[model samples]
Target: MKRIGLTGGIGSGKSTVASLLVAEGAVLVDTDAIARSIAQTGGIAMPAIEAAFGSSVIAPDGSLDRVAMRQLVFTDAGAKTRLEAILHPLIGTETQRQAAAAGDHAVVVFDVPLLVESGRWRTLVDRVLVVDAREETQLQRVMSRSGWAPEAVRAVIAQQAPRKARRAAADAVIYNESLTLAELGTEVRGLWKLWAAATTR
Candidate 1:
C-alpha cells in the first residue's frame, strides 16, 4: 500500500483534491473528520476538553460548540496545544488502523489539514502531496467560504507554516490556482501513475 499524506493550508481546496482522488479509487482517511468525531459531546476527547476548558464548550445537543471552542483555542496558545494533545493521538491511531485495514493494493490518501503542524504523522506516509494556491487566493477563499473576516483568515494562516516552508517539505506539489476541476483531476491522474510505478518498483 502507498500511504500518501495530502495537505494544504485552509481554503486551498485540499478537500476538493481529496474528493477527486477518492473518486479515482484512492482510499481516503480524513483526520479532520476523525478529530471532529472525537471532540463531539460525550466523545472520546470531550471529557478531557470539558475538564480543561470547562463545560462552556459543549452545546445543548451534546455536541462540541465548535465556534465557542474555536474562539477559546485561537486566543490562547496553551488551550490550542492542549486540544491538539488530546485529539492528535486518537486521530493518528484511527488513521493507522484504517490504512492497515486497507489491503496491500490500496492507495491510501490521508487528508490531513494540519499535516505540517502535526509533525508526528509525516513519517507514517510514503509521500507528501501538497495542494497549493497563492496566498491572496487562499485569503479570499477562506473569507468567502468561512465568513471569517480578513484578519481572522490571516490569523489562521499565520498559525500554519508559510507556503514556501510547506513547499520545501513536500514530496509533490499540486498547483491549484487557475485550474478547473477537470484540469486538477488530470494532474492527480498523472501523480497516481507516478506513484503506482514508483511503489511497484
Candidate 2:
C-alpha cells in the first residue's frame, strides 16, 4: 500500500479534495476525525487533557469541550503542544493500523490538516499532496463557512505554516483557487494515476 499525505491550510478545501480522492477508490484516514474522537468526553485523550488543563475543558455531557479547549490552546503555546503530545501518538498509531489493514493495492490517503506543522510524519508517507489557494480566498472562505470574524480566521492562519513553505515541501500541489468540484475531481483523478505509477515503480 502507498501512504499519501494530503494537507492544506484551514479552509483550503482539503476535505473536498479528500472526498474526491475517496471517490477515486483511495482509503482515506482522516486525522482530524480521529483526533476529535479521541478528545471526546471519556475518550482516550481526555484523562491526560483533564489532568493537564483541568475539568473546565470537559463539557457537561462528559465530552471534551472543543470550543473551550480551542480557545485555551490558541492562546497558550505550551497547552497546544501538550495537547498534541497526547493526541499525536494515538492518531499516528491508529492511522498506521488502518493503513496496514488496507493491504497492497490500496492507496492510503492520510488526510492531515497539520501535516506541515507536525513535520515528523513526512517519513510515514510516500508523497505530500497539498491543496493550495490564495490567502485572501482562504480568509474569505473561513469567515463565511465558519462564521468566524475575519481577525479570528487570520489568527488561525497565522499559526499555520505559510503557503510558500507548504508549497516548497509538497511533492504535488493542487491549485484550489477558481476550481469547481468537477475540475477538482478531474485533477485528483490525474494525480491518482501518477501516484499509482510512482508507487508501483
Candidate 3:
C-alpha cells in the first residue's frame, strides 16, 4: 500500500479534502478520530490518563473531561507533554495497524492534523499532502463554522505549525483558501489520480 500523510492547519478544509480522497476510494486512517476514541469512556487510554492526570480530569461518566484537561494543559506547560506522551504512542500504534491492514494496492491516507509538529510522521509516509490556506482565511472559517470568538480561533491557530513550515514539509499542497467545494473536489481528484497512478507503478 502507498501511504499519504494528509495534514493542514485548523479550518484549512483538510477534512473536506479527506472526504474527497475517500470518494476516490482512498483508505483513510484519521489520527484525530483515533485519539478521541482512545480518550473516551472505557477507552484503552483512560486508565493511563487517570493515572497521569488524576481523577479531576475524568468526567463523572469516566470519559476524559476535555474541558478540564484543556484548562489544565493551558495552565501547566508540563501537562501537555505528559498528555502527548500518553496519547501519541497509542495513536501511532493504531495508525500503523490500520495502514498495514489496507489492501496491497490501496492508497492509504493518514489524516493527521499535527503531522508537522509530531516530528516523526514525515519519515513514515510515502508522501505528505498538506491542505493549505491563509491564516486570516483559517481564522474566519473557524469562527464562522464553530461560533468561536476571533481571539479563541486565533489562539488555536497559534498552537499549530506555521504555514511555511507545513508547506515545507509537503510533497504536495492543495491551496484551499478561496476555492468552492466543487473546485476543491476537482483539485483533490487531480492529485488522487497522480497518487493512484503511482501506486500501480
Candidate 4:
C-alpha cells in the first residue's frame, strides 16, 4: 500500500482535498476523527484526560468540553503537551489499526493536521502533501467559516507549525488560495493521476 501524509494549516481547505482524494479512491485514515472518537464520552482517553485536567474540562454529558480544553491549552503551554502525551499514542495506535484494515487500497492517505509538529510522521509516509495558503488567507477563511474573531484565528495559527515549515516538509503542495471548488477538484484529480501511477510503479 502507498502511504501518503496529507496536512495543512487551519483554514487551508485540507479537509476538502482529503475528501476529493477519497472520491478518487484513496482510503483516508483521519487522525482528527480518531482523536475525536477517543475523546468522546466513555472513550478510551477520557479517564486520562479528566485525571490530567480535572472535571472542569469534561462536559456534563461526560464528553470532553472542547472549548474549555482549547482555552486551557492556549493559555497553558504545558497543557498542550500533556494533552498530546495522552492522545498521540492512542491516535497513532488507532491510525495503524485502521490502515491495516484497509485491504488492497492503492493509496492510503493519513490526514494529519499536525503532521509537521508531530515530528514522527515525516518518516512514516511515502510522501507528504501540504494544502497551503497564505496567513492572511488562512485568517480570513477561518474567521469567516467558523465565526471566530480574527485574533482567535491568529492564535490557532500561531500554535501550528509555520507556513514555511509546512512547505519545506511537503513532497507536494496544493496552493489552495483563491481557487474555486471546481478548480480545486481539478487540481486534486491531476495529483491523483500522478500519485496513483507512482504507487503502481
Candidate 5:
C-alpha cells in the first residue's frame, strides 16, 4: 500500500486534485472532512469543544461556531492549540482506521491541509504531493468561492507554510499556475500512474 500525503494551502485547489485522484481509483481519507464531521452538531468532538471554549463557540443548532472559533484562533494561539489538542488525536485515529480499511494494494490518499506542518504525516506517507499556486491566484479563488474578505483570506494564508516551503517539502509538485482544467486532469492522471506503480510493486 502506498500512502500519499496530499496537501496545499487554503484556496490552492487541493480538493480539485483530490477529486481527480479519487476518480482514478485512489482511496481518499480527507482530514478536513473528518474534522468538519467531528465538529458538527452532536459530533464526537462537541463535548470537548464545548468544555474548552464553552457555549460561546457553539451555535444554537449545537454545531461548532466556525466563525467564532476561527476568529479566536487567529488572535489567540492558546485557543488554537487547545482546539487542535481536542481534535487532532481524534482525526489521526480516524484517518489511520480509514486508511487501514482501504486494504492492501490500494493507494490511500490522505488529503490534509497541514501536511507540511505536521512532521508526523511526512513519516507516514510514502510521498508528499503538493498542489501549488501563486498567492494572488489563491486569494482570488478563495474570495470568489468563499465570499470571504481579501484580508480574511490573506490572514489564513499567512498562517500556513509559505509556497517555497511547501515546494521544498514535495516529492512531486503540481503547479496550478494558469493551467486549464484539462491540463490539471492530465497532470493528475500522470501522477496516479506513478503512485499506482508504487503500490503494485
Candidate 6:
C-alpha cells in the first residue's frame, strides 16, 4: 500500500479532499473516526480513559464526555498528554488493522489531523498531503461550521503546528482556498492519477 498521510488545520477542508480521494478508489484510514470509536461506550480505550481521567470525564450515557475532556485538555498540558496516551495506541492499532485489510491499492490515505504536530507520522507514510488554506480562512470556516467563537477557533489553531511548518512537512499540498467542489474534484483527480501512477511503479 502506498500510504499517504492527509492532514490540515481545523476547517481547512481536509475531509472534503479525503472524500474526493475515496470516490477515486483510495482506501481511507481515518484517525478521527478511529478515535471516536475508541471513545464510544464500551470501547477498547474507555476503561483506560476512565481510569486516567476519572468517571467524571465519561458521560452519563457511558461515552466519553467530549466537552469536559476537551476543556481539560485545553487548559492542562498533562491532561492532553494523558488523553493522547489513552487514545493514540488504540487509534494506531485500528489504523494498522484497517490498512492491512485494504486490497491492493495505489493509495491508502491516512486522514490524520495532527500528522505534523505528532512528529512521527511523516516517517511512516510514503507521502504527506497537506490540505491548506489561509489562517483567516480557517478561522472563519471553523466558526461557521462549529458555531464557535473567534477565540475558540484561535485556541484550537494555537495547539496546531503553524501553516509554514505544515507546508514544509508536506510532500504534496492542496490549496483548498476558495475552490468550488467541482474545482476541488478536478484537483483531487489529478493528484490521484499522479500518486497512483507513482505508487504502482
Please list the C-alpha lDDT of all candidates, in the order they appear.
Answer: 0.87, 0.89, 0.92, 0.94, 0.93, 0.92
The regions of model 2 sitting more than 4 angstroms off are: none
lDDT of 3 by residue, 132-189 (tens): 9999999889988989888777877888999999999999999998899999999999
Task: List model 2 lDDT by residue over 48-151, tens digit each.
Answer: 87888898889997788988887888899999899888888998888888888888889899998888888876888889999999999999999888799888
Residue ranges of candidate 4 with Cα displaced over 4 Å:
none
For 1-201, candidate 1 gives per-residue lDDT tens digits of 788999998888999999988887899999889888887766888888778788898888767889888888889999888888878788878988888888899989999887887676578889999999988999999888879899888888889988887787789999899899899999998988888688788
Task: Write the number of the candidate with greater TM-score, choosing between 1 and 4.
Answer: 4
Put down candidate 6 lDDT per residue, 24-63, tens digits, no spaces: 9998999999999988998888899999999889999789
Candidate of highest lDDT: 4
Per-model C-alpha RMSD: 1.3, 1.2, 1.2, 0.9, 0.8, 1.1
As for candidate 4, its clashing pairs are: none
TM-scores vs. true structure, each candidate: 0.94, 0.95, 0.95, 0.97, 0.98, 0.96
Candidate 5, number of clashes: 0
Model 1 residue 135 lDDT score? 85
> How does model 3 fare in lDDT?
0.92
Error of 6 at 47 (Å): 1.2
Candidates 1 and 3 compared by TM-score, better number: 3
Distance from true position, residue 89, model 5, in Å? Answer: 0.5
Superposed model 6: Cα runs more than 4 Å off: none
Summarize candidate 4's per-residue lDDT along 1-201 as a digit string, tens digits.
Answer: 899999999999999999999999999999999999999999999999999999999999899999899999989999999999999999989999999999866589999999999899999999999999999999998988999998889889999999999999999999999999999999999999998898767
**lDDT score, residue 173, model 3?**
95
lDDT of 1 at 17: 91
